[model samples]
Target: LKYIYLNAGKINYVSNLFFFQKDILLILKKYLEKQDTYKCFEILKTFEKKLDIAFEKEFKNIIYIYLVITFERIEKGYVILKKNNSEFLKNTLYYKVIQKDIFKNNGVYMYEALHLSEYFLSGYNSENFYEDRFLIDSFICKLLSVLKDIKIRNLINNREFLEEVIEYLRAAIYRVKNNFILNSEIKLDEIENKIFIEILQYKIKMNTYLNEPLRDEEFMMISRIIYKHLIKQKKEKIKLKEVIQIIQKNSKNCYSDLIAKELLELYPNLIENDIDFKKQLGLLDIVTEKNIKFTRCVDIKELIDLSFNDLYDNSFIEVEFTESIHKMLEDKKYDYLDSENMIIFYGKELKYKKELGVSIFFNESVMKIDNKKIKYLILLSNVDEYNYLGVSRDLQKIIESVKFKELEKLNSEKDVMRKFEEVIQGGESGF
Candidate 1:
């Protein structure tokens, strides 16, 4: 099959010959004078320069048509809504084009221009297409792991069918990114294999950067593809409810492990020097297994200063190490403080070096951050940066627990660690 780039000349040749008029363009120009139509032309020029391909007049005209249509629709309170695009592309050319100063200066029509640019660039950007294969490979590996049924297992053996699915997904992701509606005649109820549909949805959500739910039409299209090549190993019909219940029960148990494993797999280099990762799983004994110090401090800075010595004593971090941690705390102090006047400083940036340590600083007197009183400063060295979600989940339980009150009565370091562990473990803190 040939990859042909169609333009308006080929699409509207007959209509153009019959009803072409330049006076219509004059009237339309006045109507769209305030629309910033020049922004579309500028974006197209940059796209052409970047791709090193000259666009014919016909393609440019089609893009102009798209721009006009977008404005007319938006006037009627219509806007395109779809899932986010691939992070790689979004960070690269797509970001550069849209973030231009000219585009941002009252260039409302650039929205449609951006979508039209992506439609062509996604196909023409060879570098992105090459890099996207790694993402696709990772996705397929996850897909195979999720679709464990024996009948579905055989589906991967068909190379043709597999390639078709891959192409379908790539196109679907681009369409969703460009806010192009996926129109399908098929309905979700017609799909017989509901379990497979759920598995497909789970895989897409896990693998891609899509933050929104897929439209039913999109799922219907995907189901049609899978049903086309699906082969049954057994004639016996199984109850859908029973199968779904079983899957859900097992999935809940392994969900966290799956997420952690995927994170480790995706970023092995970041975890290479991570001492905490080398330890046994669930060994985030932040209170009992690390340095604990008690001192009278009136403010967050003093508390931070006291913790630096413990940071060195416990993990042997240098001055720069403390500075980095200090900077992170200073930057994120507002966000880190919980309702219980607690701060958990754990971030992904610290995972790069061997500076892995946990320290707890208990203030004898009250400390203040942003005029709010702070009592306990739990300094967690970064294990996994993304583990903030787990920490947030556990922080709520810890803050509301009665066992946390025992920390105020502790005197010695040993007692502090013991009581702190009791308070933390009692709340079942994930960190």
Candidate 2:
């Protein structure tokens, strides 16, 4: 019987012992195969008045078809039963209607009716089965608990977001169980910014109740949800003139003036304060050497440690770059010019870090001049708009000026250190 049931879709075969029961069995089979669960519910309701032991031919046949399919699916490992309890089917409107109007609250008969409806209305797929409701509910509870800890529960307080999250998680569990692939349209890193990734890490830490790590697609989807609900709408509006003035004071060059002109020409909305300047700064700060600051000499490791400690104190999160100057030069992974001795990277300092809408830059240098190794670090803060203002070009010009004039004076490492100290002290004679 099981073999015949499993092969029903393939061979167009029916059991001879059930020949007289063909019509109802074929109707139930058609409904199950096509996943027309509502039709199955209608048919199940028609049999509510019949006793289980003395069911009418139509009711008996539908029950037989359902039993065979359920047993076959179980044998084939298509159904997984969790040991948790759930009252979703019993509490549903359909179940209530059947109990009140048809079963008349007869405990014995109501149980049978519910059993039949659970299989039929849920489409007989393990993914849609009532028992899995416990798992989904548990997952949602865990998710809510984690969100509450992060003070982000208010963002998802509406029904639409809740339903969407539940649907996404349910689909994720189904895909995981079936070994299916779920692709994300956006790259994980592109949408998963530092704060978003932090939230996800917290989620992962809190999701210990789950049996497995979540799929990357699930993480990406959840990140997108957080981004849409929280980050996108909560962007800080900063003063453009204040930021430009800071850049001018820090650099002490026409570099800020050049950037101001370019900004006015390129992004007039900034002057009018009509847009989120922080977002604009993020885009503008892509230049290689923007927000330049020269610092007194220190050992390489000490410099990195000091920079890391200072930034950490100031609400800056460090995103470690894989390719250091030594690694890059040793592996020849990237083309480096002979004169290109320094590397720098920067990112926005999130509100979670310190003052909201600020940016931080880290510059690391390793210089080898005349058998002496010179190491130093420069820290730039709140100047992400420098790149758009031609700071990198201005920096190169300054480097050229220093090389042409001060290189001859710097015969030893101590001379280089003295010159850098002079620059830090606002002396007239340093780059």
Candidate 3:
């Protein structure tokens, strides 16, 4: 009975609460009195009767700690409340809307109003129709979710995005750092600065307030998102010579490791000679060396030969990632994936890296499938836009089938081999 109401979006059940449509408040109040707080959500399902103005006022009492649980659950499109325009997703009846912590009850109302506006304002933000008018809508109820998202939220309010994104990030890094705040005495100030520097370098937001910290859980979420996305679109057309030139010249204007990793994910062949990457984090100091042109730095013959192997071993396919998607990838949710236009791929590399051209994106926001598991990417034109959605079942298969890998696995005793070379050269191995 409750399930039918959630699917019936056109009926304004909450609005009709004034007419005694259903005793939603009675049910919620009983749950609250019992202190079985979790049931607050369960009570919200009673919109089975019809919506009334009182229902919105009643449900807005929900709180925040449940975001971790609720955000993931909403992807199933719950038999839930009418949480309109919440990018945070699966709006809690009591969930409050705070922009840097302010009580804004009407934002949800405004968000719905905006959807109505979009009907006349085509190509602005998409909308759904209700009766004779276009209705603005999102199921998530957090202001930050609706206003700050890269896809649907207003660009003017990106601060909200940064705040939310950083919060998620801070939580993750904080967990990694053990709950110490940024700049606290217990943590490394250098790493904090690195985080700040990267955010600033990427122009994530003007040097406003520090972005919200990502929790370990959220960081884990983003990391998974990045990994899956990179797997689907791993194509790097930038010539080896050009990459080598950037590193050799010691140019400061080089792509970040995020770009490098994504490109490498596409052109798994580049790993043949990218020892600097193996040795350095993000290839920070390695991609830059004075007097080295990418073309002139090393012999491409070895790298090229590796790429032709039917079995790719040199690339990071087997490579472990201590690297993060926090700096490299974006969060993609079910709403983004539900749109059928997104494309998916399994056996190919991205045509281009982050700088542009034939890029791949993962629908990193993981959701349950038949009480099982899946890692998927939604291949599309712009990694950020809603242009397409296609599923890629196995990115490694694409890499393997494309004949992308070239480097053989390094012998753990490769250093021993180097020592042998040193002995042959009349040098000491210090043995």
Candidate 4:
């Protein structure tokens, strides 16, 4: 004999399962209303098995919060449809099925709900390719811990830097894991470079998530960010006179006045000529020109290409060429009249039996001459004191002045020679 629910008491017993589910939902709703996020998470955990298959164990909390917040928004009639027209999300049958079945609230749009579901599924299933909030947050916590231990935490904007770093790390980690190549144009200063290496080394040692050594470009990107932060901190602290002094001391032959002038042009309020530096020693460490000639009148490519042998071979004053310059010419590193435009050597050269110092600068670029693209190499040679830093600084200034039209106009070998002589004579007058 079968027992039938013929009375109200029987109906209560038969519907006990529905009431239990309803009780759980009521508890979840109360947690949400109270804004007790942790309790809401605990309640979600209890009904984890009933959630969509796309919500993985690791991302269950995140998906649950997303769903609860989205449901709350729907109830408030404030559904926001983010613009994501990803073909992959649109083409997936799982996305379509979920859109049709789970997110059937009257207020939520079909595609918008599908997009959120697809995002959760992609993040969960493609763990190797993408990083979710949990992974990123955990990585950030560990990173901050290491930074704190290193004692350089105060040097950066902790919150801002970490947020940016987390995003970069997420992308970087995925690329590194998959052995992908990334290209970057960023370069770091010496101090920042050292810091980058130290930070990367520490991260590699401490973080198990980063399983392999990062590419140079990846390191460059990180270093660039750190360098920018360092620069921002140092900008106000760096005095113009101090920077000039640093350059003067390092360059050895550069005049402080010239350094001051160049620096003022680059940064107007950094230095004044009459300022006294009796007590303070500058802390900026930078690379500066020490043993080169600077000139503006002559093209570098034209100067290198000039047949030194043809011009000076018959002259009364014989020029003794150094073996280093000879090797450089043979290697075709410098721009020559009949050779490819290449720059291999640039520095002070010993000329005239090593008695007078000659500074040579060779830098190459492509330019349009008569509407045709031509490889232009610039050469600046000056006779100065051996390893004179002033010569290089002067040459750099001159090169900076050379315009495409000016370079294109002087095509004759005689004109090039005259321009070279003019630059050398002009540079020597200042010294």
Return the top candidate by TM-score. 1
All-Cα superposition RMSD per candidate = 18.9, 27.2, 24.5, 27.1
Query: Which candidate order results from sorting by TM-score in descending order?
Result: 1, 4, 2, 3
Per-residue accuracy of model 4 over 161-188 as CA lDDT, tens digit each: 5546766866776666545456435667
Regions of candidate 2 where Cα sits further than 4 Å from its true position: 1-129, 188-191, 203-206, 211-213, 231-431
Better of 2 and 4 by lDDT: 4
Q: Taking the candidates one at a time, how many backbone clashes does each contain?
A: 0, 2, 67, 14
Local error of candidate 4 at residue 193 (angstroms):
18
Ten consecutive residues with minimal summed lDDT in candidate 2?
Answer: 354-363
Q: List model 1 lDDT by residue over 228-261, tens digit each.
A: 6563322334433343345567885544434444
- Could you give candidate 2's per-residue lDDT for residues 1-431 as a string of tens digits? 32123221232336543343577667656655655334334444454434221223333345556755554554566643331112655664556655665457866455544655544343323322222333344456456556666667554343335556766776666556545465436565564564356666666653553445577567667767765656533555455677687776787554655566556555543353332333212212322222222334445444444554554454544333212323322332221122334323222222223321212122234554334344423333323222221222223333433641343244454454444334333422111
Better TM-score candidate (3, 4):
4
Candidate 3 lDDT, tens digit per residue, 26-140?
A: 6644533444333433333432222221222211232211322343354455423342334432132223322112223445343332322222122111111111010011111
Model 1: residue 414 alpha-carbon error in angstroms:
2.3
TM-scores for every predicted model: 0.39, 0.26, 0.18, 0.27
**388: Cα error in model 4, Å:** 48
Error of 3 at 34 (Å): 6.3
lDDT values, one for every candidate: 0.51, 0.43, 0.27, 0.44
Q: Give lDDT for model 1.
A: 0.51
Candidate 1 C-alpha error for residue 189, in Å = 9.0
Model 3 spans with C-alpha error above 4 angstroms: 1-42, 47-191, 204-431
Sliding window of 10 residues with minimal summed lDDT for model 3: 127-136
Model 2 scores a TM of 0.26
C-alpha lDDT (0 to 100) for residue 359 of candidate 2: 20
Most lDDT-accurate candidate: 1
